[model samples]
Target chain A: MKSVVVNNISKRYGSKKAVTTALRGISFEVDKGELFGIIGPDGAGKTSLFRILTTLLLAEEGTATVDGLDVVKAYKAIRQRVGYMPGRFSLYQDLTVKENLDFFATIFNTSVEENYDLIKDIYSQIEPFKDRKAGKLSGGMKQKLALSCALIHRPSVLFLDEPTTGVDAVSRKEFWEMLRKLKEQQITILVSTPYMDEASLCDKVALIQSGKILSIDTPEGVVRSFGKKIIAVKSSNMLNLLADLKKTELLEDAYPFGEYHHAVLKNESNEHELKNYLQQKGYPFEIKGTDPNIEDCFMALMKN
Target chain B: MRTLKFLLQKEFRQIFRDPSILRIIFIMPVIQLIVLPWAADYEIKNIKLAVIDHDRSDYSRSLTNKITASGYFILTDYTSSFEQTLGEIEHDKADIILEIPASFEKDLVKESESKLFMAVNAINGVKAGLGSSYLRSIIQDYNREVRTEWIQFPRFSPETSIEVTNSNWFNPSMNYKVFMVPGILVLLLTMVGSNLTAINIVKEKEIGTIEQINVTPVKKFHFILGKLIPFWVLGLLVFTIGFGIAWIVYGIYPAGSFLTIYLFAAVYLLAVLGLGLLISTYANNQQQAMLISFFLMMIFVLMGGLYTSIDSMPGWAQAITKANPVSYFIEVIRMVVLKGSGLADIKYQLLTILGFAVLLNGWAVVNYHKRS
Candidate 1:
């Protein structure tokens, strides 16, 4: 069943003369218990769309429903069904970690002891410093506490907006693992992040840019339809390699990818022939065929 | 109900954990309750006196001695001429000058009536009026003494027979401190409660915790009420400490039931906490919230009759004070503490504060948004 369905939602700030289109004709859906992801760079309207879904902001046009309740008309009901962890850590800093969790549970008309099982996994990591003020917790501990608080009431659908942006690599890995476990509890989750590596972890991914979705599909499906053979070639002079490849007639698209150059050539170009041509040009380099990952697919999609 | 309990618990924990905030909350009220009463007195003392004794008679000397012995006045200088006394008044060195005409003693014995010119500086009309009244009463008593010794009159004079008995109600001594301590306590509660709550919410907005709450199954009303409940209880707790100090140190216990004072204080706290929430809803950060709340609180406390009696103000000014919640709380507290008034005496104030609490919280909950 479709747990969340957003259709043609648009949001604009200020009047027409100076309006900022934060969300533009965006539409998507999440199935029951599916871990969906919105992958995009900063300022790509991820936060705005999350706000609309959480019922904190109303879309200017179209509609969104969370767990069969309308986003605007059924905001009160939606608030009770959805758990939202915004991009920033907004828990009461003055309150202790334990107090923060207790406060959130009470707001949902529940208790920490009642929902202890749900938050135990994440909350236990930060439990040692539960008495410490939320303001004093490390970035990773704060993320854990925030996630634990959001899950206290056991909402059906959880919306996490860039939950691991500032966290360390180990904590980020730990947080994603926690999400996978949460998926087992049969809770639908919609998470947004800027990290391409993290995108592969989600059941489905939506590549967004400039308030528009470039593509949405499973990580492998998006990579399978990358539609071009990619080549990585490096030379002793890397800058010269990029400038030289862009000037080549066979190369359709070429840009620097990490330490090597990822070059997408015309379909008709032969790999052996291209290597010979570069060899003749005295380009001391190693060339190899490369499989497309989500980052590669996103870059390809963004080009169009 | 559970939400309120949880919120109150969270508020108490927050207040207890922050030592600086706790100190400000508890110590501030006790210091203010003790110090403000002494500072906010209307009783004028140490008045500078300049005397120009033209007669320089033994009677005039005796009258000057009496004036000096009054203790209320400080005999700054003895002026030989009227011009010298006028110079002293012009220079602000003297508040009042007693001018005795020549042959003043002879006039008292022969003419039986002599006009004594008393020049009082009336720039501060209230103080000048009081000083003049004191001087007149002293002269009248001296004249009565002289008349009694010279004449073979009856023991009871007509003025003495028709005596006017005065009674000071509530605070019989008219102790300015007694009235001020309660008002200052109100001021402290409003400042600490409102500003602290305002900063708390705004800090969440700044740091992104509010977004986490928005995504939860927590209702907006629950979230808001949860947040305000803690601050409300803290305000009341602070008010209780203030009341305790008033009773212990100042011997100013409430005339009514202590429970009534606390119950009413709880309602008043809601109005104040709602105001803080309202401000936090509009503010994007802690600094902005603190600034706006500070400004609003200054206006509320100043106009709340903490320093002056609202009833004594002009009709229009008094009308303006009616809208201020602080004014009603101060009035109600004073009535309960000094007069021991019951519910009927403070019913109007109670209802008005309840109305303010509802309106402010309604506005806060409505304006409070989860989205940026």
Candidate 2:
């Protein structure tokens, strides 16, 4: 079953003098129990799409639905069935961890004791400091408490928007692990993130740019579609290396990636020709042919 | 119903947990209701009388004694120099000066009609008007005594001199504190209700928690009432504490039914809280909400007729007050407390307030949407 369906949705803001289009004809779907990701950088309309899906904002065009229910017509039912954690930490900062949890539970007509089993793993991490105000907590602890609150009602479809944006690497890893556990419980998850690395963790990822979806595929599928030969090169002069690589007519693109620069080659070029051209420049270098990663594919799709 | 109960519980816990709001809610009302009435008094007293007695006759002395003994004015300085008295007026030392002309006793004995020169400092208009009027009344009584002594009355003596007895019906002595205590009580309830309600909703918006709540199944009206009813209960609690403080400090007991006062207060508080919610819906943050609430409060309190009488206002201002929820409550509280006006007498005011309650709350609910 399609747990979520968004078709050609567009959203714009501001008046005629200056208009900002946050989402442009975006279309995607999340199957039952599948974890889907909308991956992009900031200002790439990730937040806008999440807001439209969660029913917090109206899309200028297109239609969306949760389960079999329409987003606009069945908003009340959709609210009960869906959990949305916005990009910003939207919890009551003045409320303590325990109070905030219980409050959300009670408002949903359940109590913390009843949902203790569902959120025990996440909530127990912060339960030791449950009396502390949420504002005073560290960023990672707040993320845990917020996720616990979002799950207290056991929403059928969870919408987590940039959940690990400010979290440290250790907590970010643990948070993705928690999502993996949630996925085993057969809950459909639609998560958006500006972090490209987190995209691989989702079953399927949609790379969006400037309110437009660049590509939608599995991480491997996106990488397979790069359609270019590439080589990772390291030179003694890393800064001057990119200019020299771009200066070569045999290369299509050369951009820095981590410790080395990944250089895309034209069809006629060979590794020996590239290496010999760089060595004649009086620089010590090493070159090895490599696989195209999602980042490379994203840059390729973004250019088009 | 259960959702609202949980919301109210959360709100009350937050209200109690914040020490700053606790001081504003519980402690501030008691101090204001007890202390504000004394400072807001309208009764004028302690007029400084500078008696420049140019005539050193027995009648002049008698007139001076009567003015001093009236308990309104104090004999500040009994100087004979007119220049000294003028210097006193300039220095703000004396408010009234009495100068009796030379041979004033002989003029009254021979000429039955005599004139007394009186110089009054009229800068503080209420003090000056009241002081002069009190002095004139005392002088007239002395004049009647002198005339009565010269010629005896026919049968009734001083009793039949066309005695114009004045009776103050509601407030026997026309106590300014009695009139003011009720008015200030209305003001205290309104300030607490409207401000807390406005800031409560806007604080949620500022903290971005309103979006979280909006995504819930909570209805708009339920959300509004859940946020507002806690303040409503707190407003009534403040009213109760204020009523007790008024009785303890000022010894003022509402002459009418307590039910009537609470009845009007309940409706009036709903209307004011409704207005606050409407403002919160339009305001984007707590600072904007505070500014808007204060803007409405200044207009409501000043024109609510707490210090100024509505009858003396211009036609347009009076018409505005008719739509003012604060003024309706202020008038009802005073009428119920000071005049013992019952529900039957104030039914019109109660109905107007009920109308405002429905209208403002309905508008607020309609304007509040989960989607921005």
Candidate 3:
């Protein structure tokens, strides 16, 4: 069964004449026990979409439901069952870790002793400094405490908006591992991130950009739908190669990536011809076929 | 109810943990209550009197002696020339001039009446009005003394004298401290109740914690009550401390029952805290909340009749005080503390504040949206 279903949701901000649209007819779903990711860059309306689902905001058009209840009509009921951690670290800074945890637990009509099993792994890591104020904790510890607070009630669905936006690599990796453990307990998860690589970690992802969804599929399925040949080209002089590749008629797109430029060709067979044109320009280079990652797919989708 | 309990626990913990808030909540009121009443005194004293006694007769000198002995004047300049005394007033040395006409003792005995021209420098209007009144009462006393002395023996003409005896009731001593302490205590309670709660929710908004609270299962009514109850309790705590200071430092014990004072305070805090929450709902950040609260507080305290009498105010200003919650509290506190007014005596004020409590809190609740 679907845990979350959003259909044709739209939202606008500001006054009448200077209105800025934050979301535009966006639609998607998250299955029960599925880890769903909404991947996009900043200002891509990820936070706005999470706020709509969490009932902190109202959508201008369309409808959303959480756990078989309408988000607009049954917001209070949804609030009980859905856990949301905003993009910002919003736990009471003056409160100790233990106090923050207990506060959330008691407010949800439970105690730390009751739901100790659900958050044991995450809470135990910060339990050593449970008496320390949350503001004094490291970024990774703060994120962990926030997640623990959001899950104190053992919510059926959790919405994390950019949980790893500022976390280090090791912590981000560990956070994903904890989410995997949570998924095992049959909890639906909807996470949004600006990091494209994190998209592959989700069971399914909807790539969004500028208030519009570019694509929605499994990570591998998204890569398979690229339907075009991409080549990685590098030379001693890498800067001029990108500009020169875009000038060529045989290339469909060219952009710099790390030390090499990933070039999309109009025809897969024209690779040899494109190489000859570069060689004629007195440039010695190396070219080979490369698998398009989620970012490359995102670029392809955004361009269209 | 459980959710509200947790909310209060969190709020009280946060309040106790912040040292600055604790100092503001406890120490500020103590200092203000001990210091403000003495400085905000309304009784005018030590008027500078310039006596231009043109008659320098035995009766005139005796009258000047009586005026100087009244303890309200300093007798700054005693010159015969009126122009010289006017110069004394110009230099701010004299606040009033008593010019006794040069009739000698013959005019009063022969005509049975005397005219005295007095000039008062009305620059500081209150001081001038008070100084002249004090002088007039002393002269009246001297006249009654002369009339009674002459009546001790039979005279050629018969005269009737009507004597008016005045007495001040309630505050018999006319003690400035007694009159001012209760009013100041009311103002302190208002400041603490409104200013603290005003910045409370807006602080959460600025720190981004309100979004977390908004997404919780807590209802809006519970959320607002959770915010209000702790501060409401603390506001009353401040009032208790202030009342203690008034008793200990100023020796002001309320003439009415303590129960009546607390009963009014309990309802009054709801109105003030409700106004604060209303401001918090409209303000997006702590800075905006502080600014709006400060602005409204200045208007409320100034027009609340603490420093000035509401009866003497202009018609429009008095109209504004009708809607001002602070004014009603100030009046009620004075009535209970100084005049020993009972609850039945202030039933109108109680119902009016109750109405304000409902209107303001109802408005704040309607504006405080859990989802937007």
Give the fraction of reference interface contacts each candidate recovers.
0.80, 0.87, 0.91
Would you list the C-alpha lDDT of every candidate in the order shown? 0.86, 0.89, 0.91
Residue range B152-268, candidate 1, lDDT tens digits: 876765454666899999999988777888888888888877898888778767877667666555557767877876777678888888888988988888888887888888888
- What's candidate 2's i-RMS value? 0.9
Q: What is the lDDT of residue B170 in candidate 1?
A: 96
Worst 10 residues of 2 chain B by lDDT: B154-163
For candidate 2, write residues A26-112 as lDDT tens digits: 988889999998998889999888887788999999999998688888888998988888878989888899989999888888889
Q: Can you write out model 3's per-residue Cα lDDT over B1-372, one digit (the tens) per residue?
A: 888988999999999999988999899889898888877767667899988888889988988898888888898988899999999989999898888888946688788789887889898898888878888888889998988877674574365867599887878888878878888888888888888998888989888888998888888888899999999999999999999999999889989999999999999999999999999999998889889999998999899998899999999999999999989988998899888999999899999999999999999999988878
For the predicted complex of model 3, DockQ is 0.70
Model 2: CA > 4 A from native = A111-115, A229-256, A259-290, B45-163
The global Cα lDDT (0 to 1) of model 1 is: 0.86
Task: Enumerate the candidates' DockQ scores in order.
Answer: 0.46, 0.68, 0.70
Which sections of candidate 3 miss by over 4 Å? A233-250, A272-288, B45-162
lDDT of 2 by residue, B1-372 (tens): 888888888888889889999898778878777678777877677999998878888988888988888889999989789999989999999999899888788899998988887789998988888889888888889988998899876775646346488999889988888888888888888888888888989989988899999888888878988888898999999899988888888899999989999989998999989988888889999889989988888999889999899899999999998878889888889899988999999999999999998998899998998996
The DockQ-derived docking category for candidate 2 is medium
Clash list (residue pairs), candidate 1? A84-B215, A89-B208, A89-B209, A90-B208, A90-B209, A91-B209
